[model samples]
Target: MRVLIVDDSKAIFMMVSQMLEEKGHVGIWAEDGVKAVEYLQENSDVDVILLDWNMPNMNGPEFLEKNLTDSFTKTPIIMMTTENKPDYIKKALSLGAVEYIMKPFTNDILFNKFELVDEIA
Candidate 1:
């Protein structure tokens, strides 16, 4: 799968990209929501989005709200963040996030989440 990873942290991008590669998926990254939007505009083959909740310039929820329309609305977004509050998860889901994964995740956890998402998609 071609996955778009949107996060501000360079380390997060590196780690996630490595994990995705290990699982035989191509992972493209964006430092913030603005760049992510640019990438989306240029590429229409993204299968999933691994989004970080907190970022400079534009946050994950803001990005989803702004971009998840028309064709992009059907794209799956799995939020990767430190926010674990029920309300925060609720808000993300309400705003169109398909799944949520807490930060500092392991390879197995991420892989499992991706597998679960496959069923839903």
Candidate 2:
């Protein structure tokens, strides 16, 4: 599986990439949503994408908007964010996120998300 992680924090990206690697999935990184969009323009076939809520240049929601409407890539997105507010989750899902996870998530949750990704694939 090809996983793209978009987060401003280098630490978060590294951790998530390592976790996905342990699960035997190839992972890629982008510092912000704008970078992620650019990467997608050149590369399709991304199996799953986990994006952080806050980022420079373009935020997660902004990316979702552009990705959903401006491009042909309809990659499934999992919102990995520190924002735990219910309204935020609702808004994200409404905007095209497959799921919204709070920042301090566990491997179990990650596995569940992957299972769904598998189903989608």
Candidate 3:
């Protein structure tokens, strides 16, 4: 799987990238939603997007709202953030995110979410 990881922190990206690599998947890093959108325009083959809720340029929910009418909407998005509130999760799902993974998650949790996404797809 080719996963786009949209997060402001390099450390978090590195961690997720390593996990993906270990599982034989490719991980692409986008510092913010603006960059993610730009990348998506040129490369729409991405399997899934791992989005962060509090980015500087464009947050996860903002990205979800903006892409609702775009072709990238076909790509499944999983909001990965520290926001663990039920309201936040519900809002994300309502806005177009297929799944939500709270931050500080383990590798098992991350991949398990991926499996859930596959089932949904």
> lDDT per model, in order?
0.88, 0.86, 0.92
> What C-alpha lDDT does candidate 1 achieve relative to the native structure?
0.88
Predicted candidate 3 versus true structure: per-residue lDDT over 28-111, tens digit per residue: 999999999999988877999999999998988889988886756478899998878999999999999999998999999999
Give per-model CA RMSD.
1.4, 1.4, 1.0
- Highest TM-score: give the candidate number: 3
The C-alpha stretches of model 1 lying farther than 4 A from their native spots are 68-73
Ranking by lDDT: 3, 1, 2
Weakest 10 consecutive residues of candidate 3 by summed lDDT: 66-75
Clashes of each: 0, 0, 0
Candidate 3 has which clashing residue pairs, if any? none
Residue 96 CA error for candidate 1 (Å)?
0.3
Two-way lDDT contest, 1 vs 2, winner = 1
Model 2 clash pairs are: none
Best by lDDT, which number?
Answer: 3
lDDT of 1 by residue, 19-60 (tens): 889878898989999898888877888899999999999999
**Lowest-sum lDDT 10-residue window in model 1:** 67-76
